[model samples]
Target: MKTYPVKGSVKLADGKPLASGVVVFAAPEMGMEFSSPLGDDGSFVLRSSYGDGAPEGTYKVRIERDPSKADSQARGGRKSAAPAPYPAKYGDESSSGLTAAVKPADNALDPFVLVK
Candidate 1:
């Protein structure tokens, strides 16, 4: 399927960058999904298993911490697991209420600002 570039950033309601996590874009009706790791600045560029970008469609977006990173951090040296930076709701598209529309051209989405 043809795809288009999708990029965006995530920030807290207070204007602080999330710093780490993964951003997902899922189009359930199309059975297509894309994801990207959050940069230190909380920016992302979506890519699917097939390749970079996603096909044109509307998608429900979600943000979650990378499980591998979380696991490693837990076993590494930290005495206690640090609290999650974002609310749990942001991890579930059904409840997160985040969405994006990808067009045939380049798509630079608005920042997803989450509230605590």
Candidate 2:
């Protein structure tokens, strides 16, 4: 299937970058999903098994904690049980109410601002 470049950033309601996490794009209707890890600046570029982009479709978006970062924090004796960077609701696509549309061209999504 053809795919298009999709990129976006995540930030808190306070305007601070999320720093670390994973951004998920789910299109159940198409049985397609794409994800990318957030950069230190909270930027992300979606990629799927097919390539470095997502197929054209509307997707429900979700944000999740990056397991690698969590593991590192645990090894450092930090509280790995700390709350997610964003609200728990944002972690579930069903409840996140976040969506993105990928067109035939490049997609540069608006920043997803999360609230507590």
Highest lDDT: give the candidate number: 2
Candidate lDDT (C-alpha), each: 0.86, 0.90
- Against the hidden reference, what TM-scores do the models get? 0.88, 0.92
Cα lDDT over the full model 2: 0.90
Q: Kindly list the per-residue Cα lDDT of model 1 for residues 60-79, writing each as its tens digit.
A: 99998876677676755764
Candidate 1: deviation at residue 87, Å?
Answer: 1.4
Model 1 bad stretches (over 4 Å): 71-76
Q: Which stretches of candidate 2 lie over 4 Å from their true place?
A: 75-79
Model 1 deviation from native, Cα RMSD in Å: 2.0
Instruction: Write candidate 2's Cα lDDT for 1-116 as tens digits.
Output: 89999999999989999999999999888776899999999999988788878988889999999888887877567757878867899999999989999999999999999987
